[model samples]
Target: MHTSPLITIQAITKSFKGVKAVDNLTLSVGYNEYVALLGPNGAGKTTLVEMIEGLQKPDSGSITIQGKTWQKDAAFLRTIMGISLQETKFTDKMTVSEVLDLFGSFYKLGKKVTRQILQTIRLEEKAKAYVVTLSGGQRQKLALGVAMLNNPQLLLLDEPTTGLDPNARREIWDILMQLKKERGTSMILTTHYMEEAAYLCDRIVIIDKGKILADDTLATLLTSYDPGEVIAFQVSSPLATNSLYEIRGVKDVHWIEEGVKGMLTVESITHTLPVLLNLVESSGNTITSFESRKKTLDDLFRTMTGRSLHE
Candidate 1:
């Protein structure tokens, strides 16, 4: 099976108050593909996707969908694209069903599509519940349901799990995976959670400030960076100071005094932890416990940005 590129963004740039927000950003999303847009806050992710949705125009460049997506022909594109943003703009008093029905009116979809969306979002029980009464998770589900009312071929999710509890976030993640399976819907997912990005996206675009820092499959992205790994254990004080250099793959081992904190950092995950553990045990140090610390997306993002995702 073959499909055309669903969206093309060429050198798209945007600025606010003379400060550049998006800088020469270029990306292409293939149809039925899942792409994770990851970066710390203020990374211009929202600005970039808005331009692709035709809600905002780029300062200098082009955004092209398969067909015209301007407001003039939005009626046509509406059927092919669904968008769920981090912010939910629901009127406090409106019932879930009322809001869903209202949004459905904008798309001219029939009951079949609306009903299916409601079921997929698991809002049937809360269909008549007021928006204010639903939990944050249910509200987010409703937002997704509304987005899918038109049976969109492409879905754009902007930090879909923001502010969600761990359980709610996991629920939404499962739903997204299911959508890709049942509908074969192409999705552009933006998030600050590296774990979620690593879990959901087949490929990822890592942006820092206003530049594309890395773009590749999750494995490639992890492998290409020196984000590395660490193996840490707490035990009795070490008998030998020079043993630091003896542990295999210990890129740098500086034993610090956190009461009983003992640590060995391996530069690469390719390094074996058994050797480090064996050294700790044989050294007469109490082998209290140990864990391998692989370089997560957060580690990579923080390494590049020098700040946490929330920062």
Candidate 2:
């Protein structure tokens, strides 16, 4: 059995000043799926998102939201979609509640959802604080509250926690996770942080130069693009680099320093870890620290695009 996607983008193309921001890109989001859209600065992430949001028109292509076209059903589109951009500036004097009320007024729905949204975003305590007085994370939370005023089915978030501190970012992530769990909102998040994508999204869509480079679940992407585990360790004494390579299941070894620490990409940790430990111990060297993890989306992006996601 197959079901139609909740949102579909077909061969969308957009350009600015002879530069193709989005070059015949197409994608789809399933119902209640959290997808992360990732790309470098010039990769057209913002352009593509705007086109889907109906803020920018594509030169050529079709965007359908729940089988509704923006051209024919713009009002309906507004009612069902919530967008939180990287930065949203409100009147400095307006309080959090005031800002949410102003955005809520745009829709026919009244103040019923405001309290719920405030509670969801954990801004109930600071509801009376002016927008200018709120911390960066709180302001971001208010922005999310405003976006959710219509109780949208589709949520488009653009770098929702770009500059926030670790604690604030975690707070935002927690709020978003709770919302997804409770409302099942289909969300498309655009972020440079690979950890954010891995933590929140069911699938990852990597784009480069206006085209999708890869799209798959985080596990699938890791397995398909970077199928291996990296074991990194620091030793009290140096072991010969060639000796490390001779360990079972070690496909490759990269020394961070000739005599201090190094990393190994292995085919099977079960086969390699014990052998590695034994080798280090037998060679009169003690491992000061050891850790291992499979390759991540960050590695996949670098492999495919030869550039950092933040570039």
Candidate 3:
């Protein structure tokens, strides 16, 4: 039997001041799926997400969650999803437990569920700690805990770890992975971090100029679009870009800092690296630093859009 998708969007469009923020876009999310929406700022990721969340209405087309439209099923739709925005603020006087209990109360949940939520977010030790005293990461966990109070089936997270440090970001990732593993929660996460999207999402959708440029699994995106390995290095002296391209297996060369620092996309490192080194050495251009790795989503995005995710 074929089951319907958990969320369905068809040709939805939204505009502001005669400018289309989300141009005729269609997308779907499957049950128990984790999807990441990656795009540069002003790419309409947030606009699309807002429409899906029923926080905003599209100018045209339709959005349905579990086959229910927001116009008619707004109440029921609210019950099944949890949202964690880029930033969440809580009263400074409220303790961690108190904050959870307060949000839980909105869903008519009690102390037992609140206790479980604290444990799930690993904030049991900070139950008595005031919200103001919590670190940035702990505050994010609390925001996540509040979102999960309803035991929502679908989670909408908008850059939940945006300002967090690496260690703090990993902690947020761990909690989200746990939720997906134990509860089978479906999620739509919007993030600026390629590493976060690659690690946490099963499917990645890259949007630009209010349109999806690439949508697929990480491997497919990497392979289908200019499949290759990446070599990034700096040299003691400037090197001609055309010279690097002459190496066998070299597909493309991108200079990060004119000729002194650059990255190359090659069909095989084994074939390209030795030749590249010999050429550099013969030309009297010593390598300052060198590294090689598999092509990543970051590379794919740059290839397609000619811009970095942060740019």
TM-score of each: 0.82, 0.83, 0.94
For model 1, the stretches where C-alpha displacement exceeds 4 angstroms are 1-3, 67-73, 232-265, 268-291
Clashes of each: 0, 0, 0
Cα misplacement distance, residue 119 of candidate 1 (Å): 1.3
* Candidate-wise lDDT, in order: 0.77, 0.86, 0.91
Model 2, span 1-311: residue lDDT tens: 12789899999999999999999998999888899998777788888999999999999999999999989999899888999876688999998888887887778556777877888888999889888999887888888888878878889999998888988899888877877888888999998889999899999999988999999998889897778888889999878988887887787677767866987889888889999889888988899998898876765676676565766
| Pairs with steric clashes in candidate 3 | none
- The number of the candidate with the highest lDDT is 3
Q: In model 2, which runs have C-alpha deviations exceeding 4 angstroms?
A: 231-264, 269-292
Model 3, runs deviating above 4 Å:
none
Per-residue CA lDDT of model 3 for 198-311, tens digit only, reads 899999999988889988998889888779999999999999999998898898999999999999999999999999999999998799999999988878889998887777
